[model samples]
Target: MELDVHKPTILVTGGAGYIGSNAAFLLSQQGYQVVIIDNFKHGQQFYPDWARVIKCDFSDQSILDQIFTHYNVEAVMHFAGLIEVGASVRDPKIFYEENVVKVLKLLNKMQEHGIDKFVFSSSAAVYGTPTKVPIVEEHPCNPINPYGNTKYAVECMLSDFSRAYGLNFVALRYFNAAGADVENGLGERHKPETHVIPLLLEAAQSGETFSIFGNDYQTPDGTCIRDYLHVKDLASAHYKALKFLDGNKSAVFNLGTGIGASVSELVNMVTKQTGLSINVEVKKRRSGDPDRLVADPSRASTLLGWKPEYSSLETIIADAWLFYQKPDAVLYYSDQSYQQSSVF
Candidate 1:
């Protein structure tokens, strides 16, 4: 797609991370110029050629000022934050600094630049333990861990910012962000690799025993259940959110498939997809893990005209497997910096 020079450019914070990178590519494909900023702490350095990559932390007001001055950014998709629940539990201070404090800096910059539209890359963790199976937006947010607390704090900030400064924002609370942009060669590449799908795939490939967390939950399989949404679908939702913001609307919606799959069920799907016997080892449940965390995405569908197309468990696993099988697949933390490359 040709660049629409007249359209306002979109700024993607943490555009090198899994979901941010995919969202940046999709936004560029739709002819919207994108400027990606990342501190390279947990984000991938590489991005699409059309995107203007600025290697800087969100907490740095000077660098953010430079980018805002250079580019005509009308909105921002905030995806730059720490996401490990275990790590957050261990070090709540770091999580609060990175997730909450840094975000305040970025929002201050956005306000200074008169950029009111914001799309937040929130997580389902904010909901903590869902009292109901199909969790809705109205559900009480009593996050059980520091990570969830940080996310909820940011959501509260967004609400206050909108009210005080007239900022139009949308917070999409994602369930399980799995899968990859197989066609574009982009997928999850966390250094520790805590997500279930990628961990199972790695175990199948390396013959390692994959831990099953715990089996004492009240679910059907006695394990946790999560709603998995594809990365591309997430990107699509972000795009639609930008369009939805044009009406001067500010809202919060859940990004999910409205379907639930257990941890064991996901392992079985991976086994079926790869034809490799996955070695499973049952372990005690980690702290702050909810028994079930599914989403009621009906409000998103009805309001933003958004629905996930790639919601199938089989499709999500197969796409991730394709990226994992690639011999030259890029690994996270391979180097300190990455060169600008175009996959399209």
Candidate 2:
């Protein structure tokens, strides 16, 4: 299915998170009418100032009515939900309530309102430790934790709804979303930083020690390896998916760099880029992390024409370093900026 692409009204849910806000910026630049909804659990500022941003949860029907009435929301890009993997295990109910139940409610409201097109922000975590390497979109989903389970469940619901309600959707499964909008003005910032790239940047800024979770993986470097994709490329994928769904058909795609970098390998890259030494600490393995989680993004390439551009180890570390020094970058990440030497 293809779209007119001349103009479209896009309502972006969770448009305040790392990927959501970036995606919103790209949509606006592409001449799409953009509306954003966020709960601010992970505060995002500078929401493409051009976009109409609403500060509230979409699970609330009242706000939904207002948003629907205000914007000619022809399509929706769903990104609002809890994302902590470990925490999900402790509070599976919250994960279900927030990720699964809230989505169901949102979909119900969309159906009632006759809003059918949707683009979901799904995760590759649904694959867990795959039995095969370079896992494809067709790989069996055997989520090891509640976070992954919730995303998988949502995908299931989307499939169910597409058949039963004629709801057109494109569910994007993300492999590790890293880096930022290199040529644009958006970047990654998360409070209590958990993502690897940002944490490494923070440690370099503060001269603090960075932890390497379980350095005994089966890789050559003996540290966990993950497939890291630049967020800029990812946001593009969302926009393309939106157009794809608007064609009145349903599809799914994976956004990844098609390459994996080990934990030690990433540290080495950061060290090379910033010339800052980071102390490394190895801890026990995180419960749900697979030793390796690289993606086979061939399906997306053949389907959505999506590919990551800045995921090369050098550019990924450098973009994160630039955001570490910017103020707007602080809103999404922590407020503290690492001391800089005015020269990179």
Candidate 3:
């Protein structure tokens, strides 16, 4: 999948994180030079051999100036932010600060550097308690939590910026990003893991009881339903969105499979994959837990020429089980200094 021999260099924020790292590696594989900037707040230490990994916060104007000046950065892929929904509910101020305020700073710097092309990492949480099963791009955004509100805020900001400042960007609202890039040894790694697939796999290995959150939802299994897409597919969508910006077009798309899986069903899949009995504990539903949230990803497919290849639930569980089984898998956190290039 070689692209232009001298494809434009892309600045990937939070590139050491799960999805961002996968996208950066793929971009470098496809011949697009990559420059990654991360604060390493919760990002992984698994730096790839391809990217010019810089350990700096994307919001730092001085460091961003160095990056934009040193490299011929043609676009920015913003992925750094506080993503924990539960935490966001507890403290909305930090979520707004990290996700919205810091991002605006980065966008301002990019605008100053004359870099108008952008790709945003959005969330499906924006469509709060969807009225329709397969949520579309045009669905009303009534986010029920602070995390979703932050993502929606950024989306609105991008829209206004595009209209006022000639900025071209794509906002990809992702559902549950699961699975692993097993080939690259890159999987989910959160400080306090909140995602379902990894948590279920962890419990399967450690024999810990996995909490089901709630089994009283209105779904088939009496549990909340969500659309899960492989992290690999999510990464590829970012690449496609970057290429879509080459036409100077701005659009919003949903990155998800038009399929929903319940918590009980996912637990069953994990058990099936590992051949281990998963101890499940039902708990009270968290605030604003949507009954069903799938995606009508037709807009992304039609516009970006992208579709999921590794998002099937069976494949997702298999790959994730393999990843968690490895004893020496990469973990997050490293003591790296600012402006350091981690190209190996």
TM-score of each: 0.93, 0.91, 0.93
* Tens-digit lDDT string for candidate 1 (1-344): 22344567998989988999999889989988987778668855564566766677766777777667766788999998899998998899999999999889889988998889999988888888888879999999989889989999999999999999999999999999999988787889888789999999999999999999899998999999889999999999999999999999999999999998999999999999999998999999987677888999999999999999987999999999998887554432323333223211
Q: What does the lDDT read for residue 96 in candidate 2? A: 97
Judge candidate 1 at residue 30 and give its lDDT. Answer: 94
Task: Report the poorest 10 consecutive residues by lDDT, candidate 2.
Answer: 335-344
The TM-score obtained by model 2 is 0.91
lDDT of 2 by residue, 1-344 (tens): 11232346787888878888888888988988786777677756543446666667867787777566655678888998988887898899989999999999999888888889999999998887799888888889999999999999999999999999999999999988888765565677777667899999888879899988798888888898888888888888988887777679998787777789999989988888889899888988876667888888898888777777778877877887876677764333322221121101
Q: Which digits, one per residue and each the tens of the lDDT, describe model 3 over residues 115-231?
A: 999999999989988898799998999999999999999999999999999999999999999988887778777889988898998899899999988888888789998999999
CA lDDT, candidate 2, residue 85? 84
Model 2 steric clash pairs: 189-332, 189-333
lDDT of candidates 1 onward, in order: 0.87, 0.80, 0.87
Clashes of 3: 0
